[model samples]
Target: MSIETWLAFFVACWLISLSPGAGAVASMASGMNYGFARGYWNALGLQLALVLQIVIVAAGVGALLATSALAFALIKWFGVLYLLYLAIRQWRAPAQTMTLEHRPIGRPLSLVLRGFVINFSNPKAIIFILAVLPQFLDPGRPMLMQYLIMAVTMVAVDLVVMAGYTGLAAKALRLLNSPQQQRLLNRSFGVMFGVAAGLLATVRRV
Candidate 1:
């Protein structure tokens, strides 16, 4: 990829990461429950899923998956169900005062897995990547190297964006002093997750 093409892709990466989706909801949810220090593991899991998606696209499996109605439906339903599960969990979270120091720490691996599932199950992401990544590809240049660059660029941007989302929620948590306030915020996040699931359920291959 030339410098100009790479630069354009880099900008696109930021925009993609900034867009609100299941990943953002997961990040904020984790941050709300845990603080930035532990919640950031969710971002790592998200990056892992992202890299895998890029690899799938680069290897051309994304095209096959996109065309397969059964595969797409399976993945899409899984994602929707998972998001609804998350929403229910959030809704049922015990009401407590907002105190990061006093709150019990969540297992990092569980958070990571949560993040991975949130991204990995989204068929829309695979299709989006399949459509977008090829636009910057140079048929005259080596393909593997271009894919590697794009993957790295996308992951780096997404990490930063997820961190910002997580941190923002953590900071917001500090302002809520009562259990009522905490419960309200938690349920709000639950609703957000449900909304995300609804949106995901409506996605169709383009």
Candidate 2:
């Protein structure tokens, strides 16, 4: 890719990372419950999922999945169900001060898996990759190298953006000192998760 092309793709990546979605909700919720240092696991998991999605796109599986109505529907519904489950858990979460000592989000493995599933199951991501990635590709150049560059750019941008979201939420955790305020914050995040799930469910194949 030429410098101009790479620059354009880089800009697109930042814009993509900035777009609000279920992944952002998950990051903020995790950060709200867990401090930024620990909450970072969720961000890491999300970047991993982003890598997988990029690989799927590069391998052409994304095109197949995008074209397959049944497959797309199945994945979409599973993502919606999983987000709804997260919403329920968040709603019922006990009020507690944010502390690295009291980690209620679950084991590191669970948190990572939760983050992975949040993005991996979203068909919209696969579809977006199928639709958008090719626009930045150079057929005459090495496909794998180009894909790698694109993936790295996306992961780097998203990691920074997600960390910022997590940080802000974690900072808010300090101000929510009272039990009532904590409960309200938890419930608000729960509602955001539920709303994201609903938005995912309503996504149409186009």
Candidate 3:
């Protein structure tokens, strides 16, 4: 990618990162409940999804998914269900998202995969990548390389932004000391997740 293209890609990505979305919400939730460590894993999961989204966009698989109504809804609703499940988990346990020492003990491979799936289950991510990536590409250039460079830049920026958000949230959550407050906060998060799932379920396919 040329300098101009790089600048544009970065600027757009920066704005998108700042927007409140599933990835940001997840990162913030982790930061609030678990602490910076869980927030970091959450952010990692989010960045991984961005990589997948860009890859799908670059490979032109996006168009196929878009054209197939059944396929799109299947993925979308599946994403919704996954989000609901996550919300339920949050409600039941409300584990501190930053428990580096006493966190839910699991296998390393499974932890990594779980983190990845948490972000990848959102179909809107794939659609967003497909719809937005093409606007930055030039048909005459090496398409793959162009997208590769752009996507990498995007993911890098996103990581930085998410980490910062997580840090701030972790600090804030540390302030609330009461058990009642913690319970309320967990319930609120569950509600937010449910609302998000509802929104996704109701979205009209484009």
Leading candidate by lDDT: 1
What TM-score would every model get versus the actual structure?
Answer: 0.98, 0.96, 0.87
TM-score of 1: 0.98
Candidate 3's C-alpha runs over 4 A off are: 94-115
Candidate 2 clashing pairs, residues 3+ apart or interchain:
none
Clashes of each: 0, 0, 6
Q: State the TM-score for model 2.
A: 0.96
Candidate order, TM-score descending? 1, 2, 3
58-81 per-residue lDDT for model 3 (tens digits): 778878877878878888888788
Worst ten in a row by lDDT for model 1 = 97-106
Using TM-score as the measure, the top candidate is: 1
Question: Which sequence of candidate numbers ranks them by lDDT, best first?
Answer: 1, 2, 3
Residue 189 C-alpha lDDT in model 3: 74
TM-score of model 3 (CA atoms)? 0.87
Number of colliding residue pairs in model 2: 0
How far is each candidate from the true structure, as Cα RMSD in Å?
0.7, 1.4, 2.8
